[model samples]
Target: MDFKDYYETLGLERGATQDEVKRAYRKLARKFHPDVNKEPGAEEKFKEAGEAYEVLKDPEKRAAYDQLGANWQAGQDFRAPPDWNDGFEFSGGGYTEANEEDFSDFFETLFGRARAQGARQQSSRQFHAHGQDHYARITIDLKDAYEGATRTISLQAPEVDASGHVTLKTRSIRVNIPKGVTEGKHIRLAGQGTPGIGQGKPGDLYLEINFRDDGHYTAEGRDVYFDLPITPWEAAMGGKVKAPTPNGVVELKIPQNAHAGQKLRLKGRGIPGKSAGDLYAVLQIAVPPAKTDEDRKLYEQMARQMKFDPRAKLGV
Candidate 1:
């Protein structure tokens, strides 16, 4: 799909405020209205301005568009990012009507079906109801919870079409998962849900948060846990060993005679937040297998040299 720069269409910079966008749309509409200007392409320009307003004037659409980033040029071949709206919750409430023939393909690509249906419903009905709120769960990376990240989420919901029939439609949007968000928490995106019936206000979208389960790490509350595998020599020699934490790896000093299943705590190294949680590394000592003669000889020598009897207490 070829992308359209709605900001460019209105002769405004990407940073234009809502008021600036509204003002620009009005000015452009008046200057290029076919009935007033009658200039070549004036009608096209007018429709373009309206389409731009249709997106920029709404916060949710504007945000979704902005997530595509600012580097795209107008008319550039574009494809919607996969899972672009994965974590976002969008409610539908505000919409402006335009003839399907007036808007370009790009406009329809973004807001065509919903806007057309809402407009048609508004004209046909006197009573209106608020749009329905939508909810979904999104699974994020553990690292994202530590440092924050943006995710694309796809949502399938029932949408009313121009024929007055409801059909399930899939849409995508991008959302920012804030730092330190834990599982079961929610992110809210206002006006990114189902469009209201008639002239009613749109409902909000709520996204439940879930974190990916990583093999190396497990989290409970803000605390993070990991298993630290070490050699038998390293466990008994009292040396510094590199331990893995969510933030990164750090040298952990193992005391002489450190036992299996012992936990070592690194303060404030877990999930980041006020009163941050700790990272716990549980130690597991692994003994080398005696495969070669030399290794077996060493084991025998140790068995004879050291007074060790692990099963002595079992009275075997």
Candidate 2:
């Protein structure tokens, strides 16, 4: 994809302030508006100005774009960096602020398809008195993300009774947990939320995902990390040590002279799918106590044989 310099399109510097961007967009919009300027390519120029302003106007989109770095020139070939917006939050309601049809393919690739078609369809209706939307949280084990599972979530809300009086209601609904769902992701249940008023449709339920506190491994997005404990001998002499991953236990080679907290990457062993995440093994050395006389003698003999001072770097 060729990079589009939004700042250049608006005749402003890269560090232009918000007010400057707005002013430039307004001036360019007026100059190229098809109705005002009947010149050739005026309509295309007007569309270009709108696209530039569309991205620069939104703070979230602007920040994401700025992450591409400043070295890129206009019309330079570009590909989005891996996991560019990994933890960034966008709306789960499938509604976007921008008109999805107007933006170019580059915009869609950077920012996902905005403006859900269903949302547009719903807006054309004349129904008034819509139902109130509901939100709830659901937590599951990390394994549930690897292998999909069904979870029941309970929700409490106030609903109108037959007597025209509001009453508290508690209900439990079974939700299917899909594989590869990470933390902070949501599951939308349409028409399963609060009941509608009059002839209006029921609102949808948004269930936010949370992982249980499992001490075995730590997860960041799709990547997983676990500590691999090994003896000093294993660290000094590179050996294969069995390490635990989300999938199963696998032999991980400890590099010679491996120090504590040293990491080794197991590519594509994390959350399953295309573009899967990598699993990291952090090395931790565990020393055995010299309790027995034989053990003490062996440790003393090694101490006398080896003239190693760990604090030599500290000048102690």
Candidate 3:
């Protein structure tokens, strides 16, 4: 999809303050309003100005959009990076405009549809409205799931300054990660969202769980998987080899003539919970290079002595 530089659309610079953004948008809205200007593309320009203001006027949306960096130009081919808004906290519904369909695909791609109709419905109640719930994602180590952990995470939210410029307000929060918590799980923090209206209660903050990519390990549901490298001798003959688990390292038994890609399961060694998952150690054979004469002789002796043909079953 083509990148829509909101700032450029409204004839503003990247560093334009919130007030500048507002004034620029107002000027464009007047110049392009369909009733005032009967130009062929006036209506389209008006819609574009509205869309730009929709994002720029809101500090939270503007902060998230600014993350795309200042190097991007208008109408450039653009795709948002995966999880670009992962840690950003957003309040109210995604897009508050009444005419949602009028927004372009570029807008939809950045901010998804309203999470629920409750936010919009609640606006009708003028007496007391509940604060808008916020959502974000936090990444943790895989070991944090095995053993419950307390982590300190920093989050950024937009704050309007005295000059009406939007600035990011950063705060550090300590969170508890429950044991056996898998990916996609959410931890809720009460009264951590946008402030309420009148005597309404504050909203909540929901943090989605994600595990950092550790090269050695991967998880599926509760089950854990990792490659266990073994010497060629260990694969040829039964032996005990040290394997690393989330909890700790343990000795795993290799079967006689164990082939590469064989899996050895450790019962209840995965994430710790009422119904724990299993840990699979996928075996990979490691061959020693024949660098010296003795090593070469040893390999030559094995090749000559062993009459086994690995491809015999393939009829090659």
Candidate 4:
């Protein structure tokens, strides 16, 4: 795939407003469309404009491209640096904003195939096409994945207006997050995407699931892992301890003399699945500080009564 300057293609500055980009694309598309104009390069020019409009028109793709900086020239030798998109919020949704398979190589390099986009656009062209399908991604608590949830999302769609002009409109709608849905998987919403042109039907919408960052645990596949803080005595004399899970708090028994970082597993406590993963509690021992006289006396007594030497292995 080649490189493209979406900003320049639309004849807009890098900082152009979403509205500005959309307006530019509408004007150019209408002007250069082969159906509307017979110029020799009309089709090619229209495609180039569409490709640019596709990226700049979306808030997500725009942000990702913006981070590439406004310094690189259009058509310049470009390759994604190792750290490119290091901190951007790409859903890896990886769909072209333009509907057709008519995008430039530059577009495909960054994002994968525009297959879905093409399908929707082409389907829209059918004489009685139904509504096109839309796609989105959202993050929620692992609990949301465990137990179904209801969430409201805001959608901004780039659409063709009554005058055959391209424009964007914003709307919000509520959706259900089904239980046991995993990351990178999609949830479909009937009649949610772009409305069909003519007497065509409306398209469906699909949303991919992602987990929000949690302080208590990190999820992988179907498993959940968490660090459990414990006192020194608990490590030396392990017993039942309280642990947190998506469902609720639960008691986990640990073996006596359990070492720090020892893992305790609770079967079927993780994500819901046929062979559900277990929840792991990795113990982190907390040493008491010598802030009180009693604490200092206990340490002094231990030092006097024990011959423990941490540096003995170093022959110090």
Candidate 5:
């Protein structure tokens, strides 16, 4: 998708404050409003101006957009980073005034999800008349998922100053990480969302769970997987070896003649549940480097004595 420079569309500078943004958008709207301008492309320009204003006017949306950095140029081929909005606290999904389809692809790519979510929240609120719920994503250690934990997390929401510049207002909350919680699971904190109108109750805050990439483990459903580095001798002569698990280190039995890429399952060792998931220790043969003369000699002796052809199965 092409990058749309919202500031440029509204004839404002990148550092323009909130008030400046509002004025520029108002001027553009008046100049190109379809009813006032009879030019062939005035209507399109009007729509573009509106789209730009839609994003630039909101502190949260503007702050999130600013994160793309100032290096990006207009019309450049662009794709938002996967975790661009991670940890950003947003209310009612940053609802937009118009249908998402009415905006350009650039706008939709940034705020479309928010618009859809806002629509759902709005629909529900019409009946319940509660405050809008907030949402955010919080990353926790994988061990926290295995063993329940209570952690204090900080979340930031954007606020606009009188000059229209965006600033982040941070708030800290204590959250309980339930044991066996899977990725994408949400922990709802009641009455933490936006304030309600009149006598309506405050909305909720939903925190989505994510695991940090610790470089040692990965999870799929209830199953956990990690590389268990084993020496070549261990692969050849199976015996007991120490292996690391989420809970702790445990002795694992390596069957005789275990090969690289072999998986050793530890039943009921994964994320705890009624039917607990298993942990898979994927074998990786670690070869010691022949840095010394003795090491080189030992390797040479093995190569000469083994006479094993690794590629024999390939029929080469």
Candidate 6:
């Protein structure tokens, strides 16, 4: 879908403050109110102004919007980046009466569903005790935990309609990633759940954060470990070698006489977090094959001359 310039929609700059956004929205809403304006599509424009205000007014929503950046022109093709929803949250199946079809793909893609019209009425219908809470699991990356990121997750929920028939609704929501939010910690979004019945509040929506596994990065607790195999010569000779981490590859110094399975620690190089974590490089000694006659002769000569017998302890 083409991107909508929310700032432009309200005739504000990309860096417009929340108060500026709120003021702009009010001016536009008054100027374009369907009831006050005779121009065609005034209602549509007014609605757009309202939607933009909703996002730009709230700190959480505004932060999420700012993440999208001002580089995207209005009507530009848009796609969410890896960790777009860093610190906001949503619960209900994306669209509701309060902010239904009036919202844009950009808004919906960035935030949670708005309260539907007559949500109050729906709640009054009362389904006995508060309905059971809903559950959703959102997959985040290990780096997200390292440095607390935001994410917009898509979810589909099953619910029964007024006719007692079950239906599925899809919603995409944004949630803040708290520091050290390890796998399985539920991020709860209040008032963003299914409506309750007869004096019962709506059920809550719980988001469980899960980390996506990386082939190169093995994340355990606050520590990261990687195995790097080097030629026996590199282990024996003190030198700088390239080592990989979640951030990227960096030069690591291996001291002379470093042994196989020796571990080197790089402080504060793991995932991003408050206390952060460390990166460890474990050495694996690689033995080259004696494929050439010269290579075979060298091993044979060393074996014959060296006084260091590996079996010296086991006299036979």
Among these predictions, the greatest TM-score belongs to: 5
Q: What is the C-alpha RMSD of each candidate to the true structure, in Å?
A: 15.9, 12.8, 4.0, 8.5, 3.4, 15.8
> In what order do the candidates fall by TM-score, top score first?
5, 3, 4, 2, 1, 6
Instruction: Please write out the lDDT profile of model 5 over residues 50-133, one tens digit for every residue.
Output: 888888888878888987888888999999975677677878855656545668888878777777667889889878879999
Provide the global lDDT of candidate 2 against the true structure.
Answer: 0.72
lDDT of 6 at 280: 88
Model 4: how far is 106 from its true place, Å?
12
TM-score of each: 0.55, 0.56, 0.78, 0.62, 0.83, 0.49
Q: How does each model score on lDDT?
A: 0.76, 0.72, 0.84, 0.71, 0.88, 0.69
Candidate 6 global CA lDDT score: 0.69
- What stretches of model 3 exceed 4 Å from their correct place? 1-4, 26-51, 72-83, 98-109, 113-128, 287-316
Worst 10 residues of 3 by lDDT: 113-122
Displacement of residue 175 (Cα, Å) in model 6 is: 3.6
Q: Tens-digit lDDT track for model 4 on 1-316?
A: 3468887788988756777888999999999999999979999889999888778776556665666777788878888763454323332133544555796666666654234454545554555556556655566678888888898776554444555433545567797888777766778877776677678777777776777777888787888889988877777787888877789988877778877888888778888877777788888888889999999999999889977796999988
Judging by lDDT against the true structure, name the best candidate.
5
Worst 10 residues of 6 by lDDT: 87-96
lDDT of 1 by residue, 18-55 (tens): 77888999999999998899879998889889988888
Q: How many residue pairs clash in each candidate?
A: 15, 0, 0, 8, 1, 20
**Which of candidates 1 and 5 reaches a greater lDDT?**
5
Poorest 10 consecutive residues by lDDT, candidate 5: 93-102
Specify the poorest-scoring 10-residue window by lDDT in model 1: 158-167
The per-residue C-alpha lDDT of model 4 at residue 222 equals 81
- For 1-316, candidate 6 gives per-residue lDDT tens digits of 8787778999887656656776898899899998899899998898988887776665435555665767888888888774454323333322233455677777666564233312433464453455335455577887677667787777755433564333445678778887666666788777566676566777777777767766666666677888888887798787889987766789999989898889899998875567777888989989999999999998898778965575878995
